[model samples]
Target: MAKITYIEFTGEEHVLDLEIGTSIMQGAVDNSVQGITADCGGACSCATCHVYVEPEWLNKLGDKSEMEEILLEEVCQPQANSRLSCQLKVSADLDGMIVRLPESQF
Candidate 1:
């Protein structure tokens, strides 16, 4: 398992223990984290799962796919480090990553 932290726009934080193959969106939904809506269920079609990845952990998450890139453009207040949580797969290499939600999501 990996430890992932999800911080909401209101400063609420939820730390989750995620299975290695799970998507970050799934982790949030499974743990009841409020910010990630995951409306498309990790299909890479919806942007509701947007999260701003901490700068230091950006490289560890790997590159986004073409579909994810296109969908990200539709999210509100997307940033340089913004990502779709459903697109991020948990693994040993990302043991302690941190992500923040945008206000629009809440």
Candidate 2:
């Protein structure tokens, strides 16, 4: 399992143990973690699951897909490091990934 540390804009942090090969959105949803709405399930259609990859961990995550890149623009506060959690598949190399939640999910 990969350990994902999620931090909110307010600096609140929560760690979740995600099964390998599962998407970040699924990990959050399965654990009922707050801040990840995942309105579109794991299809990468909705930006509600948006999160900002911490600078140190950005290079460790998967590259953004064309679909995810398009949807990120609609997220609350898109940043260069922004990604849809649904697009981030957990892996052994990403064990200590840290993602920051936006202030809003709309």
Best-performing candidate as measured by TM-score: 1
Candidate 2, residue 19: how far the Cα is off, in Å: 0.9
The backbone clash count of each candidate, in order, is: 0, 0
RMSD of each: 1.1, 1.1
In model 2, the runs with Cα more than 4 Å from the true position are none
Per-residue lDDT, model 2, residue 98, is 92
Model 1: per-residue Cα lDDT over 17-51, one tens digit each = 99999999999999989888888888988799999
Local distance difference test, each candidate: 0.90, 0.87
Which regions in candidate 1 have their CA more than 4 angstroms from the true location?
none
Q: What CA RMSD would candidate 1 show?
A: 1.1
lDDT, candidate 2, at 51: 90
Q: List TM-scores for all candidates, in order.
A: 0.96, 0.93
Over the stretch 1-106, how does candidate 2's per-residue lDDT look in tens digits?
8899988778888898888999988888887778899988888788899998888888887688889888887877788898898988999999998998888999
Measured by lDDT, the strongest candidate is 1
Q: Which pairs of residues collide in candidate 2?
A: none
